[model samples]
Target: MSGANEEPDIPDLPAADPLPRSRWRMQLVWLVPIVAILIGGWLAVKAVMERGENITISFKTGEGLEAGKTRLKFKDVDIGVVETVMLAPDHKHVLAKAEVARDVAGLLVDNTRFWVVRPRISGGTVSGLGTLLSGSYVDVDVGNAAKARRDFVGLEEPPVFASDVPGREFILKSAGLGSLDVGSPVYFRRLQVGQIASYQLDPDGKGVTLKVFVNAPYDRFVKTDTRFWHASGFNMAFDSNGVRIETQSIVSVIVGGIAFESPPDSVEEADAAANTQFELYPTRTDAMKQHDRIIDKYVVNFADSVRGLVVGAPVDFRGIEIGRVTAIHTRFDAQRHSFSIPVEIEIYPERFTSRYQDGRTGGRISDDPRGIANYLVDNGFRFQLRNGNLLTGQLYLALDYFPDAARAKINWDKSPPELPAVPRTLQSLQDSVTRLLVKLNSIPFEGLGNDARTTLRTANALLSQLDTEVVPRAHDTLTSAQTMLDSANTALQPDSALQQSTADAMQELTRTAASLRTLADYLSRHPEALVRGKSGDKP
Candidate 1:
């Protein structure tokens, strides 16, 4: 075995044909490594090329943002990752660096808006609820601006409407914000058509200015004469029309909203321009009462209490409303040494003239206020304070004819022709009550009580005397009369002498009649002598 092994070693398999150096040198071992390196480099290049642009978004808070964990989303789809979260140079805000996909690079516009999306409840709506489980994310809303941008200032609150949304904006001036919220719906004839975009104090600080957006097509319905009002909560009103309860919807009642309508009779065909300014009324009735005509202001001096009268009280003429009370104040008339209420009122005469006119424009009843006032005075028109709602204690101004009203004249020389005013019925009743109270206070209660007591004692004594003395005398007189009557009855008994005398008189009368008959027969036999004998018998 040793010898065979030695021989095999010696043979060495003919040196295994001396593996060619060229072949060994040309081996693909290095090529394999090179190809792998090349492939790795290509993959790296592709990864770099596919990477997106990095942008920094400054936010007031870092609430839901996390480095490398939170993603930026568009339309609910992830489009980028938050690379880092750090404070800005000023340290006033958090800067979130995000790497957005290259395909969505064009969406980073100047007007692009970003906000953190977390479960939030606002204006009776629950939004971003799905994020509660999936984790909060950064939401990006692309804008329609032409210029592209990288750095963006994030929005603290989500925008009510997207920049690219088709709509028209309008500005409404209101006395107050009421219950309106950013997400409050706007209704057109009870149909939801838009939403309140935003609101803030007016620049002049006189009222609130609301920015509203109406979705496309529906916006075209807006006209110059359109009216808007707050349609939130229950509208409980008691007027001449009686008690009324109105509500837009249960949701609106809770969250609040705005409503608009283009009065068919007032609105023109053309659409209102974008950002048109309009007045926001407090109620639907008020909005409907708005007229596009000149208003005339006047002042009324009343000698009655204006306790129940308030601003915006109805000013009526002959049971029809023609104006509203604007202000009420008390003034001292030094000359007359009396205090009176000076009430300011605004009247829209166009409301009355429009009824007789053919177009939107109408003529005023009278430009010369003094002349009109004189005419009204002659017609027995006078102002009086009356109860509007007895339960609510609300009052209104009433203009009516009072033919027998106290004579009063209008002072045309005054700036606002002072119209005559009759004392309010309530005031008259109060005066009567005061007079009756004075009369009662003046009565001498002590003297009246003494006199009444004395009268009562005298009447009681007189009654006692009549019962005791007069009654006994009357009884004695009646007894005496009864005795006399008994005596007369005894004298008229049936077998008395008067009865026998009456029977004898009857027998004598019968004998006389028989004699007269015998005489009459003799006269019939002898004519003349019988006549004389009959006559003697008759005598």
Candidate 2:
């Protein structure tokens, strides 16, 4: 009993300090698991807040797309990540599922555009080259749509420019695509200012329609009369001047491009509206030829062969181009019952406005076509076919004053007033030559040749006689005449006897004159003494 009491007392005495009950209630180790639970809950809530929405984009192909690896970028900033890639039900396209950041969710709209970005060579340009090593990525373009969307169709090709980019869009209609590509550059005065956004066949199937974008400052240059043309490939032109080669740039030559230019100040100025339609010319020169002027159409009937005449030939007035040949067709004249070539031409009367003046009123002449036509007809103006290029055999119509042309009235009542046509010079010459050939063919050439041969033989014999007999006789006569001339010259020499006798006669005449004067004086003095015997006179 004593040992148990002592041990108990000692054990109690060793821990005599009192401890709080609350402190002993629960150990700190017991709260570790609860704290860990709370931290996990906070992390879960943060993940929920940061999670993004899932979107499905349909693409023509799955090229360069990798689930969980492909990043969606906007303005070079990562915005989303591709989550999965799968084929659609119809298998017409590949479905790329992506998870975009919550902050960019509003950007995924109906008008948003998406495309894959990889190393691409387009329109003579190298793009996305950095993607080759860093791997391909998806590109997103935000839209102005008010309604948001999740599902979208991806563009097969990247857009030339973003929709939100400050630019103006215009529609260009062309007969052919030419050298223009999707990303072809657009130029203004040889300076790069825009690009070819996209192209498609016209709904009417008449031509190809291209959507082009011009940057802001450059868009102002596009007026209502602005001209657009394909300035691609090397332009090589040969004319009277010489060879001319034109190219916008090396890139334009390699791929293709479009260029635009505002018309001269002569044209009325008007801002071109967005999406305004314009014609795309094949060449810069062709576009430059276009002008804002009233066009007058006329028809001409040619009686001569128009073998070398073709459409698009120039209609010139004194070497100045005034119009073009629109059509060349053969039509049977019902009234005349003869076939004639009907050439339709488009004349720009406005081109002559600068020279227009009313002789009577001294004011600007009326631009009315009828008035101009009447004036032209009264002034002996007529249409004539001429050779444009003698070597190429190209034919053109020339308008000039033909005062001696046959009198023919213009059928003003006809639908397209017919201009009087004069006979082509070449055709008239050919006809005259043909008539001459016919006349030559009709002549008795054989008989004429025989007569000519006989005459030639007679002439040859006569010439031989002249050469032999007549020639020698003529030579002898000439020699005798020369000898006579020499003899006469010798007889007429100053020192000859004839000359001496002439000189003595002159001296005697002088002496006689002096003696006559003295006798006359004596006769006057003694006129009455001896009238008959004056001064040694025989009385």
Candidate 3:
């Protein structure tokens, strides 16, 4: 405003255009970053795609497995990611979509196993904490197991590494339903050897049947003579020493397992000629030593021979678990009440010696009962009753060799006897108890009743004599003394002596009554104490 360019304030010209942007410069700034972003996305897709290599994995249930998040890991390193999850046509396996890393593409082989690594304690696998962070993953154990390149089925865990193939199949039947849980393991010498493949109820629904698999070299040792028993839980006994069998570890317990003692020398071999198709229960044959016709024939009819035994009573030939009483029933005839029953029994051949040498001859597989019995008796053999189930009062035929001189000979017959029918039913056992109660009720009580009456009469007579003779005399003496005192009081009326004397008498009377009450209570509870204090009194 001063001189101005003293030209009178020419109006300010509008601001000139802020320089225009060049197309080349614009392309450098904006277009480049957009192109870079596109390229980056494409690269990520390429990296994640398995390209030519693919593998399938299975999961028990595909509840939480979102294909994008579930990854395949090789030693804690992400090697692939699940791209898709499809249900198998058979619905037995869950087919996974796996895209392997370029470096690990060659590792995918036909026998490659891919199992879900989730929080579980089953069989030989345990991975609880990993499931907490990232959910379950397909854990790949790269191996040279399979020769050809083929599609793989992912397992729930790594395939158990067995040295060789499994041998014979063993069937275990357990009474007391629901004792076994699914996915339990089978062990040999405390080492995980196999798993329980499946379980089902018998046709009659009386028990559970277990299909136990024994793998490889170890399975060969489980011959027909092996002993199988439930080795789980706290088995405590007071005799000899308290035997307690506990789980070796916490994880092993979740998967129920079975352990059997190794057979002597005979090894079970697979019948390669036998078809892969299996029978639920084939005519069970001994896999150890050849069965003797005589012993086998005799034991088959064991139930018919021992059906007359009591419920809690033992059917001991000498003390071995050959069989047990399964059920009892009664039949009433027109003439009299009678019972004919079929008893279920189990005979395990392992307890007896398969082969023995007779003293009269050389060593051989003896079928004669006398020869077998002689061998057993000499080796301290005896049969006794074993109480296996205390709740049901059930007994088992147990065989144990004892060096006792009073060994009894067992008469094993080729056929069961058509002897007189006996009481073998639950109803019969109840009837026995009822008969005992009736006999007890028949005992005489009349003589005892008369003695009790005489005692009561004696007590009442004694009470009467005390009341009439002793009590009345005492009352008269007290009255006389009171009258004499009254006379004395009249003479000393002015001195107030009679008033004080009456008060003292009342106090004395109250104390005497309290003492009498205490004495009465004591005598009632302990009448004998009163007689003891009085030496002349009879108890």
Q: What is the C-alpha lDDT of each candidate?
A: 0.86, 0.88, 0.57
Best by TM-score: 2
After superposing candidate 2 on the true structure, give the runs of residues whose Cα lies further than 4 Å from its correct spot: 1-50, 236-245, 264-270, 334-337, 355-368, 434-539
TM-score attained by model 2: 0.70
What are the per-residue Cα lDDT tens digits for candidate 2 across 404-510? 87677788898687888988887788899999999999999999999999999999999999999999999999999999999889879999888889899999999
Q: 191-270 in candidate 1: lDDT tens per residue?
A: 88889988899788889999999999899988988899999997898999999998878888999999998765673788
What is the number of residue pairs that collide in model 1? 0
Separate clash counts for every candidate? 0, 0, 19
TM-score list, all predictions: 0.67, 0.70, 0.42
lDDT of 3 by residue, 93-168 (tens): 6777777877887777666666666677655456457688878777776666657454775554444442234454
Pairs that clash in candidate 2: none
Location of the lowest summed lDDT over 10 successive residues in candidate 3: 274-283
Q: What is the C-alpha RMSD of each candidate to the true structure, in Å?
A: 12.5, 10.9, 31.3
lDDT of 3 at 444: 68
Candidate 1: Cα lDDT at 260: 92
Per-residue lDDT, model 1, residue 66, is 93
